[model samples]
Target: MLYLFGAIALFVIFDSVRGYLKTEDKRKYLVRLFLELTVVIGLLFLFGPLFVLSPLKIGYSTLKEGNITLYYPGGSIDMARDVMEQLKQAAEMNRQFYKANYPMPVVLAQSEFDMLRFGSYPYGGGTGSELSLNIRAGQMTTGKIAHEMSHRNLAMLTGKSMPAPNWFNEGLASYIGKMDEYKKPNELQVDLREGRYVRDILEMRGILGTPKWILKIRQGKGRVLYGQTYLMVKYLFDKYGQEKVYDFVVSLKTNDFEKAFWQSFGMSEEEFFQEFTSYIQNYRGEPS
Candidate 1:
């Protein structure tokens, strides 16, 4: 549409110039040229930014580091480097943990709305086929980006999405991403002892597949739930080791979830929960 407008505007200007040459009418030619320029510039100003940016273009600039490519708006050059290195290190860590060599695109959005505009929210994540992270402005954290990157690693390692409770996915992302970095260990102990940080997986199940649940989680439930899920995943991963963790994730889409987990961990959800309940009650701080 802009191109069509531009072409027509150009024609008007040229015709006006031709008329000026033929008749020497200076004001007529000037008015026509001015109007044409004004309309053309208006069209360019109105739609130029949108046409040049994603979903049409990824960003205003690009930077490459290892297997990661960063797309972000103009800002501090040094900050972009720092952000890239931070996420690259994170992607590398997830790769090492899961034995994944997959690549990912990291998009550092200028704002929450910018993140959404590029199809990257609620915060960050990547699907199997494409490893990527879309982070909102000022939300940079190793755990946050790592959590999303881990999902891509999982998909790359398995070559497909896994079928499992959303909890397991969140747990895996949280655990490997090192969510404990933001946690106040002593405060966690206090929360647990005060019955404020209880891990109520049963209650969590009731909220799934609902819009209200998404809103709640996005608003605040994620903080508590991620902490709870992180601890549970850490316990399981530590017990079974890395390869087994990979086995467990891939198996989710291949077999009965219960059966797959049982085969991988040698326990059912009932038994696992019983043990987890006991462990959390006495939890003090980070494990040595």
Candidate 2:
């Protein structure tokens, strides 16, 4: 905010001096500058610190693909193109993995400020075929986009034919996004190694509705939730591969993820959850 004000002040002074020196009527362009400055400042405040409204007011270019469209600012053409390529690659990968071509997600990124408009947004998130994504203006990373696309592809792949219980949405996304790919030890493992871990999936597995519990938002507990679910999904995916787990998601359309669990992994939820916790307890860092 200080920088913004300082910039405005500098512009105002420069414009004032330019009008005085270059124009017969110094007050004329000075007045115009003041009006323009007012509008710009109003927009800046109205749009928050992110300048989201600047591009919105100015309008942005759109890039269209088979099933995706990227809305981006003119200055971000190169960055936007890069993201487009990545999305296309992701779509192709999803096609091979799902055995079906679904409506790919719409990718939109202009600035982090534009992304901040999303309520409670953390980097980016996707639902079905719509994606709200964020990038660092001229930069792109694989964290949030990968995770959200994990949710999107599965949702679209199943379409209306299969309605997953949605318990493992984030976990499933993290699994497909390959959070482990970065080779960063998860918070769960770090805490466990430090002997500070206390939450027990084994005890809570059957008592709490897995879907309800997983879906619930408890501030500051996202790591625990994501860690446990990611490990569980990783186990399932590694054991049965992507196709089998997708079949299990399809089976969940009947709202019987319990039955799907058995069919997919041949184990009850409680047993599986307990086994997963036990595995983490005995196994070394990171899941193989």
C-alpha-based local distance difference test score of model 2: 0.57
In the range 20-63, model 1's lDDT, one tens digit per residue, is 78877688767877887777655443333222233434335677
Candidate 2 residues 1-288, lDDT tens each? 233345778987886787679988767877977798788667654453333324453445777788766656667677778888877766555555566655553435444446554311334343222233334444433544556565566655554312343336656766755566422335556656775443554333322343344444444445666666677778887778888887787776554556777877888877876776576667666444
The TM-score, computed over Cα atoms with residue i paired to residue i, of candidate 2 is 0.60
**Displacement of the residue 203 alpha carbon in candidate 1, Å:** 6.9
For model 1, where is the 10-residue window of minimal lDDT? 45-54
| Residue 176 Cα positional deviation in candidate 1, in Å, after optimal superposition | 1.6
Alpha-carbon error at 114 in model 2, in Å? 1.9
